[model samples]
Target: MESCGMSFIKYLLFIFNLFFAMSGLGIIIAGALVLADVSDFSHFVTSDLVGPPIVLIVMGAIIFLVASLGCYGAIRENYKMLVAFAVFLIIIFIVEFAVGITAAVYKADFQETLKKSMKKSLEQYESSSNNNIEKAAWDNVQQKVKCCGVNGKSDWSSTPMSCCYKDKMDESDQPEEFCVSGGRNYIYKEGCYKRLQMKIESNTKILIGVGIGIAFVQVVGMFLAFWLAYTIKKEDESK
Candidate 1:
């Protein structure tokens, strides 16, 4: 009955590790996609913004490798490999915990940092020219987010065509004069910074939650691998 129980745990650990391996692969693919898309808007993204995708790629690769170790160690009942897998998992958990704590502690600063970077980008916006990625990014944000300038309409000496109200737009494909006209009230009053900051916070919370959940699962897998290996070792000694 003890041997049977050990075998069951060994299989369970293998399944857990297998699932984690697949999840790691998915993260790697998602990070690669993010990196590729961000490259197109490189001028708009700050160094801080670039770090997440690269970290994701590295963490995913490491998780995949450690999961393989766990799976093989469990299946083969290798005591040394199981111990190594547990040790690696503990290290990863510690690192992830530290990161989470640091992020939480510095969460307020993230908004300020993002706001400064965004304001810098907005100060450089040129509506007549779409030749640069920064201008293109701002145009897209203004058009899609339905917000004008970094703070409000007053930030712009002349409103960009993107901020013009849809109803007042002329049939001409060229830039509308209504956006710049002092008599017109077609410009959006809200700032893009608040909208962007909200989005960033929401995404950050989701990623942190996912990271914590993954780390918890790794901890469970570590215990299961260690237990299974210990059980196998004891059984061998009795024989």
Candidate 2:
């Protein structure tokens, strides 16, 4: 019965590691997509905005490698590999915890920094003929968030078309009529900075939650790996 139980645990660890490996791959892909999409706008975006995706890709790669070690160690009953996997998990857990805490501690500062960056981008919007990526990013944000400028509509010399009230604006209306004349009433009142701050806060919370959950799982996996390694050593010594 003891041997059977050990075998069951070994298989369970392998399966868990396999699943984690796949999740790591998914994260890598997501990170890659973010990096690719933002590459053209690197000069305009703050380093903070560009850093996460690169970190995600690197961390995902590390996770996949560690998970592979765990899976193979369990399958082959390699005690050294299991120990190494546990150590890797401990290191990763510490790093992730530190990152999460830092994010929480500097949340307000990050928002303020991002707001400043957005303001700079808005100031250059009309004059930035060399970089369409930055312009497109701002336009997409305004259209999707239904907000204009870093502060308010008056931040722009003329109201952006993205801020035009959809109900009142028509294809036949000239830009001067719908976008300039009496535009304050037709444009969205809220600033893009506030909306962006809310979005950043929400995403940061979710990321922190996910990091905690993953760290918990890594702790559990480390325990299981060590236990299995001990059991294998004991069984071998008995022989």
Candidate 3:
């Protein structure tokens, strides 16, 4: 006969696994948001910034799958599967810990990179004639961020129409001379790099917080899995 304590533990483990699986979905959503946030700064930063979010998405998928196995094992009182689930939770915890640390360490380096790369990106945007897509993207970013250029209006000898404070003034309606010599009194005064750096820091903090929070939960899960597995093993040996 199963002891009352063991029965209680079994139900508790099942419920915990259910919660873990749901949290996995939350992590995935958090990762997606971080990835989207990185894209907003894509014009200034390299592809390396996407790494943490990608890792989080993959880890969350893994957790969701493992939690299913854990739930099944807990319900069936399967010792082997319970042990496997415990191992997976430990592996996930280690991965999250490593990723969180790496992201924290690289935050300053990435901000420096963003600052250094801005001028080069602006130069590329300016020199390319087939940059309609780039132009539109930049205009959207500029309007949303309310920033003039990499540094200021002075950063552009030919600033885009979006830089001008006039609401939806037609670019073609401008004086030919104004178009040719693109400095305008209405140009947005703030720099984009500074504003974007603040964005990066805020989004990265959210990512790291999610990873750490999930990792701590996994630690609790690992303990329960191990305890339940050991209890089942002891019970079997005595039979």
Best by lDDT: 3
Q: Where is model 3 more than 4 Å wrong at Cα?
A: 166-185
lDDT-best of 2 and 3? 3
lDDT of candidate 1 at residue 101, scale 0 to 100: 86
Per-candidate TM vs. native? Answer: 0.79, 0.79, 0.86
List the candidate numbers ranked by lDDT, top first: 3, 2, 1
List, residue by residue over 32-136, the lDDT tens digit for candidate 1.
Answer: 766654443344556766676778788889999999998899888888998899899889888878877877787778667777777777766643354476667
Better of 1 and 3 by TM-score: 3
Candidate 3 structure quality by residue, lDDT tens digits, 79-163: 9999999999988787777767776788788778877787766777799967776677678778787777887767887778777
Candidate 3 vs. true structure, TM-score = 0.86
1 against 3, candidate with superior lDDT: 3
Q: State, as a TM-score between 0 and 1, how close model 1 is to the true structure.
A: 0.79
How far off is residue 94 in model 2, in Å? 1.0
- TM-score of structure candidate 2: 0.79
> Which parts of model 1 have CA positions greater than 4 angstroms off?
29-45, 126-133, 165-186
Residue range 96-185, candidate 2, lDDT tens digits = 888777877877787777777887887777666666766787777877776778887788886667776645544344343335533443
Give the best candidate by TM-score.
3
Model 2 local distance difference test score: 0.75
